[model samples]
Target: MSGSNKTDFTNPSTFILLGIPGLEASHVWISIPFCTMYAIAVLGNFTILFIVKMEPSLHGPMYYFLCMLAISDLVMSMSIVPKMLSIFWFNSREIDFNACLTQMYFIHCASAMDSGIFVAMALDRYVAICDPLRHSTILTNPVVAKIGLAVLLRSGLIALPLPFLVRQWPYCRTNIIRQPYCAHMAVVKLACADTSVSSYYGLFVLFCVMGLDVIFIIVSYIQILRDIFSLPTKDARLKTFGTCGSHLCAILAFYIPGLFSSLIYRFGQNIALHFHILIGTICLLLPTMLNPIIYGVRTKQIRDRVLRLFTHKGT
Candidate 1:
């Protein structure tokens, strides 16, 4: 690429998001579902937070982690969806350089925090089921607070360098992002300078956060299942397994599509670009929408409270 073809400065003041290239004609129709999903995610997560805070019995470690997960979901969805909708509906494609980087940071940080919450949730289930005698002693209030603080610090510190790394790059190539939001790769790929450092650092962070978390979750669940099966009666086994049903649903809802979208973003060169973008979008939105619904329906305590709250309001 010649200097004549690139931007004049080392950095452009703004980047234009294309809102899923190759699907411009369907932007309006696509925004409909995206908007609906965002709305549902916001309402569902807030409802979960409110109910958890209001109910005394739900103040255990599991619900505290649930509140953290809800907060992460809200941050993740809000960081991208509003800007995405603007691009889709109003053709408001221009995002300031600083604003773009801020979006990128929040999205990745929230994702890391969400992954950590899953690990915490898994451990909570493990303690509750595998070692019921020591559950409260192990996961006391102070300990839970420390775990939450550790998660927040780890996520924020790890993601703190991303925006700075991006800002250091000379983005002279083009200012047009092909996706709906300021995805790290999408933004970094626009730089005229070498992005190998950024790419490698991103991979390092991904493995450090999500990879280790996945392994821990797998080990915890294995122990949980082993203990669950050792119970003598069939009803005992079923009851123990049922206690983990919501967490299992949440883990599946988050990790499966999230990991698939991440892999596709990195290695799916032959895949359609539009398909890739859509999958990434769904990866962020789907979990936010499904998590609260899964917990609300699967957990008896939450379900009963939700029903009672609505019934009281109707009276």
Candidate 2:
């Protein structure tokens, strides 16, 4: 990231991830809530999976998509949270280059899978609302399997090159990754190569994968809204809108903070490093923790199943 064209071909060294550097004294305190959030995220997502599997009445496209979303959140959060907590609690900040690359790949892949599942969920709603009769036909189990595979491939393949691109470059600038994990841009910034290609390629993947998904999601909503309003009765409209509320909240939770964090990262260079880290961490973790909760509250079946599970446990 230093404005120098010369490369330093020194031996590769480990990276030190100083988790929110300025507030080292309170790292333990900061990890307290993160630990709670991580625990909740793990348990809640599994609960969703278990309920979807055990409840035969819930064996359908919507619940399958929910399962995928839960799994994606679990993957994304698990990939980053443990290392992050280690950095905060134990100061276990040293990460090897290869391991960092692998983690970065998984993180991006999981994020892409999450976004893809969101789009699929939106499409599921569209079919359910706008074409009720054909909903089951259009999103059958085979189709859902294909959708899941596509999401995984798109995310895993697109992100595969990023680490290799960084690897080819010499990182003589510094071995300190400012954020808690080995983020793509953060790692790239440490490289002493012609990084413009890698940067542009990342943008390309972002737009091609997530941007396209967002556009389809928006279009699905537009069609869904049009159909809902055109219904003959207020009850029908209310019922339909109710179905979308949980998804809407989930979408906002995923994108709003995510986009805000990205914008700040791109524009707010003048901002303090620790604050940037806080917001970035929040964007990823908050959604991971909230999605399961949102789905549980919004879907009566899930709520009821959760209660039943607890009641049986009590018995």
Candidate 3:
């Protein structure tokens, strides 16, 4: 390839996020609310992580999953909130391509971790409720550590290839991404490459990993409910379900919106692309804000621990 004939692929690598063009009107009105939500999401998740780490009583498998959830939420929020705030505050849509890839990596990694943690939480609940006697032996420290490592590996394997696929493409100058953050499929659609392969493969990965996790969770909970009902008393059943209600809520909050966005994009009546972006942003951001509080407050052990810490500090 002669130097003169070579494509000037080196145009100062920057991308403009078009953002939700329709919502651009709401930009000023939503800035404060967005910032408040971001702050609450980060702080809430971090608090859950801190409480779990400090409270010895919450050291079991249940809290372990909560800690994992907190970490994932924290990372997920951090991955996009700063850029989003910048977009709102400065009205600058520009994000460097490298930065975009970095954001996508963390977003996907955290999303995968979130799904994995929910599965682990469901299993933990199943064990505790269904086989209380063996819970200790089954969910041993070594097993917990191994599970954590597996979760990390699973998430990385699913998300790591995404950026590589995007980076290899020669994206033309129309770099304005339609969403608040860099989403894998959304960004890939812009790439000037045969994205059919990437799209099909990405959907395959999503369905295989996330679909399996969701199925396992459903099966675990069904067994758990049966075990709870088999017990002698209503109080006992309620107590068992009560322990997991928070986690169940978090799972619903996380999955439902995501699945809705996916369905809307795939099969809904013809809508503007920006509407998809808006739905995606809402689904992603709201869950990050709600998961920590839902999982943290519902678990009395964690709530008590957080209170005790604050009590001691005040003293």
**Candidate whose lDDT is highest:** 1
- Indicate which candidate wins on TM-score: 1
- lDDT string, candidate 1, 6-118, tens digits: 66667778888999899999999999999999999999999999999999999999999999999999999999999999999899988999999999999999989999999
Model 2 agreement with the true structure over 172-279: per-residue lDDT tens digits: 777778888988988888886689988998898777878898999999999999999999999989998999999999999998888999899889999998999898
Q: Against the unseen true structure, what C-alpha lDDT does each candidate score?
A: 0.92, 0.88, 0.82
> TM-scores, in order shown?
0.97, 0.95, 0.92
Which is the winner by lDDT between candidate 1 and candidate 3? 1
Q: After superposition, how far is residue 200 of candidate 1 from its true place, in Å?
A: 0.6
Q: What is the C-alpha RMSD of each candidate to the true structure, in Å?
A: 2.0, 2.9, 3.6
Ranking by lDDT: 1, 2, 3
**TM-score for model 2?**
0.95
Off by more than 4 A, model 1? 1-5
TM-score of 3: 0.92
What C-alpha lDDT does candidate 1 achieve relative to the native structure? Answer: 0.92
Higher-ranked by lDDT: 1 or 2 = 1
Where does model 3 exceed 4 Å of error? 1-12, 272-274, 310-315
